[model samples]
Target: MKRKKFASLMPREALKRSKSAPTIVVIGPSTSGKSTLVYVLVNHRIIGFITVGIGDKSQTTIIPCNFAFDERIEKDEHFAMRIRIKDFSAKDVHIEILEQLAKLFASNELSTEDTLDSIDVEWFQNILEPKDAAYHLGKMEKQISIEDFKESIADVLCAIENAEPSFSERVKVKKKELAQQKVKISEIRRMVFEDIWGSISDDLLARYFKWLDYIGENITNNLNLLLGEDNSLGGIHDYSANEDDIFMYGGTILQTLFDPFEPFSLIVEDITLACRPRTEIITRSDENIPLRFCLRDTMGLTQIGMDSNSIKDALDIALNCSPDSILLLMNLEERDDVIAESCDAIAEKLSKATKLDVPVNVIFTKADRLIGNLVNKSNKETVVLKQDDYDATILGAIDNMEENIRGYLTKLPQKNGMWLSLRYLDEGIDPIQRALKNQGSDKFERFTPTGLYQNIDEIIRETQKRILPEGIETPLFVTAIDADAPAVEMKVEGKMISNIFNSIQNVLTEDNSVVNGYTITTKYTLSGRSVVAYYNKLQRGQGHTTRANVYGNFSINMKAMLNKILCNEIPDFLTLYESQVIGTVVDNLIDIELEHLVQEFDKNQHYKDLAFCDINPALISKWSDKQRNTQILHQAIRQYFSSSEKYYMVMDKVAFNLSYGNEQIRKIIDGVYQKPISYDQTMREMQDTFKKIFATQAFSAIIAKEIGDAMTDLINKMIILV
Candidate 1:
């Protein structure tokens, strides 16, 4: 069977596109698997190293390793080095392996040097065999000073220059030279070790040992700070120990192994002692590890005299690289109040100062204590339900807790965008480690028996989507359901329909067109309203009932379309009048003789009305003029003509009516037009005065009748206009 393997299988086209993949920063607490994530991203392998200090954590492993690939190196140069210094067991093994190599080199050199001395003795015996006739070779070997021995060898080599030395002769000469140089080489090796060990004073070494002991105590005080303490770095076997002595011893052994190569370096400072610095040795190879990571514990904020300036300095160091993501480490088991307060301050400052959209991931370390309590309760339950039953309850409880914390945080005003995670005891692998490995890929798509990688892909994908301009549409449909009802009950369908409509409206209004001049028309229909409820007993049924019916249709045009209504209706009063008149009279009095005259008068008066209506007179003057009699007469006549054709034919109708009316009323009507009733009128003067008064009064009466007729016509015209 073929061995299974995990590798990125991006298409060639996808690979091309990935050339500009955005950078991502993985930030979390010390044991939250930031380094492991970088490992999996580049090497498809898990790096089991645990970083120790805040400053010593890995920045990036992939980019540096990739850079090293350009420099020719053995083994592809892309291998990721685990920079976690606190994983003592693994570090110990690494140190032991290198120490063995160093010992092997020493042992081989010593043995070879001894063998060369014996060979030189044998060569001297061969040269001094008495019958060989060579010049006193044994005496020469003893009597020659070391400097003279080297000179004689050089002279013999010059005398034999034309004569090619045989392979056997060359081997003999090489053995003798190796024998002479053996003691000097041994001294040189010893001197090298001495020089390395002597760099620090005995007092300094003693202090380091004491500091190492203190570190062990600190680890016990905050055990989660140590590798494998919370099971995050891996399980602790017999190797688990909280002793500063052991850590320091381990460090010494590590230094001996790696100091030769200068693979990595870290500066350690004592926060309580004015930040006194010390350098630690790492790596044995001459070439530096592509990535170097470090970790350091700082004094508590109170211990450090938590001034704003000092806190800012620490934050600057923590955020030096402007990490795309920030992990705020909070030890739940420690002074949580202090941690929470510090985090709030840091978050506030970061948000105000930086334009970088740093997503903060908060790790509640020592979560095992909380988890253990939950698990114990779950186990003691009487029912032996399926695994999912237990898991669902636990996850639901956790989710509720998470939501409560989020709600509390959101109220702070400074805690926007902070995400939370519990640092669960690593049963076999770190949850954060699994998250980092599964991100940017589709391997772990669902929640497994263990929710190690829960929602990781969602977070990463969302962040990437925000950064990239790729036009990927994600369709989200929301249907609001009443929680009191069954899951299948849909209280409000298309809950986001209003939002969708608004979005479309916004787009159209902002752009003035959809796809340029192709106006968008939106229509909404009320499908139906439905009622669902559980009933104890019904006429025919015992279970719940669901009822649905059609409601109605409702719509609104785009503002642009509404503008068309205004443009067509409000400008010219004459056009509006003619439209109303044609609509009414066209059906009522199409053949009337006055119809042509009405149409002709409207055509001639159109331009004048347009011009006069355009002038917006002062309201006071307009109102005052309306109260005068002549103005009123003119208005009444205009209204009459505007209302109906019968106003224009009023003389014809009035003459016919008057002739047919009762004689007495007809006489009164005709007398009013002929003369005014004047009590004191002289024969000639009275007739003139009566005629003048009659004409004025008659005109007023005629106008008043016309006004009444026009009002009747206007009422009828309005019905048609509406």
Candidate 2:
């Protein structure tokens, strides 16, 4: 009954007044079920893994993707209501808009009793298998000495660097000797596993390896940054190379560096799926309602080496943000100690980055799997524990886990540190894992879950007290419902997910998190607004001689295009390319928000200077997947727009939304303004023109519509990547 009442309240009720939704960044290792959790959060259904894509949920979230619930509310003559869930996008947006309008016409009954419960229902069965990533890692044979393997690689590199082209026999014999010590597949796999994750079985190293793909990928993509080297040395002195053989050794270092794994990374960059959930009632006294926030997904922990690129992008997001709390997720099947230790490392890094004491809440995923063990192992085990016993076991295990992770969390000077270690609250609110170092010499206050707040306004009021802005992190243990598994006694609502959503919702609605409304202070350029042209695929290579580089039977010329842009040659063919890039950038956010983001960009930072970046035109061989391609393009746009010189001077001035062959624009922009641009002189002349353009907010409004059109426009067509 409480669960039903909880769902009945609109998510908006748990917020502060703001222009943009606050961001709740979700960080964890791979195989953590983040994508499905986001999907279910928005759609309220567990579509089978097959429908989600390959059994790998890790790969499904190519960017830091977010999911939000779509509300379909219908009021009954009585006070009771049934609120269905859907994503706040697509056709559902229209249906919901109508439903909202209908509510204005109908009257709602005055509540005699404040107590009302609404139940959430699942529409489909969960077909998620116990898809494990580290299951085989530990069991691999470790006969290969890691030290020896390193030595051999070093020897090979030494041979390559020292070998003179004039002599051949000696080099060939040395190369043959190195080949004899050929590294086997198993040996290399173990080396990679140990190198990336640390040693197996005993410590956080294992957990790091286990989740590298997930959380690690999240950094590169952050749903979208699962964010991403080499050298030489010694004993192969006898090896000599013939002059003609010099070419054979080319790219050897690079090949050897990446020989252990495929070049493809599962996720390309951070993706954020934005959402709107409407399930609350309007309070007559309430004012300053805040806009909802975005959720950013980040990659997990691994034995990140300096030579690797994956950790470079992720470290900033995973550690630097100033959050009110940290929702650390731990898999139940894994060791509690490992999870605790890894979480501590995160907390430690977070403390160093933000220097604030943030709460670290360890929420365990796949808790239901504890019950599954009763049935699956009923025959093999001597005894099976009941539901109550399992609950006790889990609670007791948390107590034990505190001790394991407390060592890292309380490592402050002279004292164990002041924390809800659980420490005291400020504004009746205190950070979970902030820089515990500065919170005085007091001992840990205590440890336990801070009870749920009855009024979300309390949270907002508390947050406003901070002099500096800080975000809150809420860890939620997602409910795992397996349609095939036998029914268990646990109530779905009893899980901590409800509390998590409420906490996250409250954080998202903060004023500081929202975009501040801004007035236009910059000049506009509309001289080239009328410069429209039809986009033609055949015309792409016409701008430059190198524009049509051959790749298989097709032509996707990224190199030639870049060269022309640098040389100030704005080609007409780029119009089509720019459209594709813009479409992909908005389609997938590289660690940026989704629904709330559009509104955020629309309101405060409108009229972004048009520019282009990357959408994977090609790699070393062929085109990459949609995820990486989207990431590449999204980053490119972000890169171009972010640079003052690149954005304001070069691309925006020269490339005014290129269109080719009638695909986009039908009219021709002949007698194009082909003249040298003197910024100082040009600005003086166009001052009045820009003033007139700024008078109308047309350009400001066009961007939001353009993003919308890009989404709808691509729906009818497909860009094939083979």
Best by lDDT: 1
Q: Give the alpha carbon lDDT tens digit for every residue of 283-369 in model 2.
A: 211233322333344431122221112222233343333233334334444555555455445544544333333333344444334
Model 1, C-alpha of 318: deviation from truth (Å): 5.1
RMSD of each: 44.0, 29.7
Model 2 lowest lDDT segment of ten: 119-128
Model 2 misplaced stretches (Cα beyond 4 Å):
1-20, 43-58, 66-272, 278-288, 299-317, 320-326, 356-362, 366-722
**Which residue runs of candidate 1 sit more than 4 Å off their true CA positions?**
1-20, 29-263, 266-315, 327-335, 361-369, 374-400, 411-454, 469-722
lDDT of 1: 0.28
TM-score of each: 0.26, 0.29
- CA lDDT of each prediction against the hidden true structure: 0.28, 0.26
Clashes of each: 11, 94
